[model samples]
Target: MSRFVVTERAVINAPVEQVWEVISRTDRYAEWVDSAIEVTDHHGIATVGKTYAERNRTLGPLQTRSVWTVTEIDPMKRRVDTGVGFAPLQDVTNIFEFERTKGSDGGTRR
Candidate 1:
């Protein structure tokens, strides 16, 4: 298969720490993410070396379930890494990063 890089961003009206608190929870993905319909399965803290059991719909009638481990995490910079899918079959790695900038009005620049 071909490998391509993908980037995603979200804007939240909260502080970096505030956003981190919410985003770090793997079980709450269904609340914020569109694909993560349910956290059917998982093990892991919000930090690195944790694993998450997840079930998700990918496209029309396509879905996947697997143990996604926290491969890398940089909470200070709001970055994370997760590995998904059957390793011996198809491997999918997800890297999530957040940039927190300061706005002039003391708001978080998400």
Candidate 2:
């Protein structure tokens, strides 16, 4: 088996719910996700069993398309997706998490 891990962290200047709203919409992934090239078909809001077809840029000029299913979702907390067609990876999964940050003014930072 071959496995790899990629980690990215950022402080999005928005509230937790606001960020969740954007990430929950599978159809909008390609609009913000740098690696996603295009979404060919997105049924509806992300939910278990909901699937979407996406074209992703793996490395440089190499690209691949895959059908991803929403395997797990925790409302405004976490989301997990899994799919095949990633070649040597055979099975692949992606997880998205959101955390509320408190601002000095007693408001949510992001």
Candidate 3:
């Protein structure tokens, strides 16, 4: 098997606090995540050791149910989670980091 790492960076036109407010909620994945069909189970908050489940889109017309557990968090700065059930992929880890841009207009780089 081979290992791979994917990194994506984007500047969001919102304050870091605002971005964290949305991303810190596990139940809000479906609202912003394009591949998320629905969040099946969650406590609505992100906390270490907490788990959530989601119905996600896979290949065309295919869907997979995945369970994820929050592994780490740094208040309004960063978050990490690990998941399984997407077959052909195992123990996938996702990291989300937010940084406030140095500008007169408050924005977030994530």
User: Each candidate: what lDDT?
Assistant: 0.66, 0.81, 0.92
- Pairwise TM-score winner, candidates 2 and 3: 3
TM-score of each: 0.77, 0.87, 0.96
Q: Where is model 1 poorest over a 10-residue stretch in terms of lDDT?
A: 101-110
Q: Which candidate leads the pack in TM-score?
A: 3
Structure candidate 3, residue pairs in collision:
none
Better of 1 and 2 by TM-score: 2
Q: Per-residue lDDT tens digits of candidate 2, residues 7-110?
A: 77777777777788888898999989887899889976998998998888887799988789999999877889998776446678888877776664322322
* Model 1 root-mean-square deviation: 2.9
Candidate rank order under lDDT: 3, 2, 1
Q: Candidate 3, 109: how far from true, in Å? A: 0.5
Best by lDDT: 3
Count of backbone clashes, every candidate in sequence: 5, 0, 0
| Model 3: per-residue Cα lDDT over 1-110, one tens digit each | 78889999999999999999999999999999887999999988898999999999989999999999999999989899999998768888999999999987898998
Query: What is the alpha-carbon lDDT for the whole of candidate 3?
Result: 0.92
Quote the positional error of residue 65 for candidate 1 in Å.
Answer: 1.0
Model 1 residue pairs with clashes:
41-53, 42-52, 42-53, 43-51, 44-51
Q: Which stretches of candidate 1 lie over 4 Å from their true place?
A: 86-89, 105-110
Q: What TM-score would candidate 2 get against the native?
A: 0.87
TM-score-sorted candidate list, best first: 3, 2, 1
